[model samples]
Target: MALIRFVLQSVVEILVLPVTILSYIGIWDPLYKRFFPYLMVKITSAINDKLGKIKKELFDKLPDFASSSGLSILEVGCGSGANFQYYPWGCKVICTDPNPNFERFLKKSIAQNEHVKIARFIVASGEDLSQVASGSVDAVVCTLVLCTVQDIDMVVKEALRVLRPGGAFFFIEHVVADKTTWLHFFQHVIQPAWRYFGDGCCVTRDTWKNLEKANFSELNLKHIIAPFKWSLISCHIIGYGIK
Candidate 1:
């Protein structure tokens, strides 16, 4: 079984190489934009069903805004707004992303998620969110975004800076697996190609460790194997912390 897994992984990598190259050249942007959301709806929905109570337990507890209206959430990388439906009721969301290709999907998501109001759509990278005021939002929600940022530290710092005291940073991101495992070795080997094709994603990134280094206390965090048919990049952590 292990040998078969290795063979399958190798075959998939070989097939994605050319596609990854095109992605690095900017040709894959529109294609990814068009397909990623659909893939996510299928993937994240299953994840929700499996994670049932866990998802609601955390999101329901997010800090409320000063106006008592709702939680003020600033989502970094807000990809196609895949997590929009899960947002708490009456939450005010500030969406930020570097990719202009996601604008249409985001607008559509905003329209669909009537519970969460769209406050603004900032065309900015996570590392530099100058348009968003510091110590303003009640929470910073980041899902599957830490892996792709050029500077994870800078981006995390900005998240901490913008969050009000006692605000939370909610995250769900895949991370590097056990160092001695076959999967870890495979990830290390294919990281360069993976990032190129995956829009700067690092499947081997120890994102939870990086998050620990940030200026916040850990509230809840644990790793779970992602429930995808293709599980190579499936090891992920889901949790949040107060700022």
Candidate 2:
């Protein structure tokens, strides 16, 4: 029974992986980005509570504000505000994404999490945060977004540019596996197709290393394995750095 089940599962994964890659990137990402809000709610429904805890951990690291409204959090690639419910009540949020299609999804999330205010929705890329002023925001939050940005260095610089002194950059992203292994080779082999299908997400990017180069005053991060089903994308890093 075990052998049969393993065979069946392997076949299913083989079929689903290819099609998922092609459709995700080539078919329609803008339209799919809109659907991602609902898809994510369903996909992460079982783990939402756990994810909330992780997000809260990062948010808590930010310095408490002296102002009435609390800290201004700039969420780069805020994709439908998936982390909105995790924020403290009354904290100000500035959600930004290059794709305008996600605006409708953001509205729904904002309505659901009314306590945390959605102060602004900027249609901007992570590399070019021209709409946001330098050293303005109290904290910057980015999750699962570093993989797909056009320029990781520019994006990190943009995040740093908007952060006030002593503020933190909270990030949670899947990174490249270790160099001395077959998994690392696998990641490199499928990366081109994966990048196309995953909307420019390079499964092999060493995002943690790039974060270190961003010149944060206090840098700290570590890796954690994801659930088994995402084995290929299982190497994840969740941590924050004070600027």
Error of 2 at 39 (Å): 4.4
Q: Write down the RMSD of candidate 2 (Cα, Å).
A: 5.7
**Candidate 2, position 163, lDDT:** 88
What TM-score, to 2 decimals, does candidate 1 have? 0.81
Lowest lDDT 10-mer window, candidate 1? 61-70
In model 1, the runs with Cα more than 4 Å from the true position are 1-54, 63-69
lDDT of 1 by residue, 30-89 (tens): 777566666655656676676556666656666443335557899999877777777877
Candidate 2 regions off by >4 Å?
1-50, 63-69, 228-230
- Model 2 is weakest, by summed lDDT over 10 consecutive residues, at 60-69
Q: lDDT for each of the candidates? A: 0.79, 0.78
Residue 51: error of model 2 in Å?
3.6
What's the TM-score of each model vs. the native? Answer: 0.81, 0.80
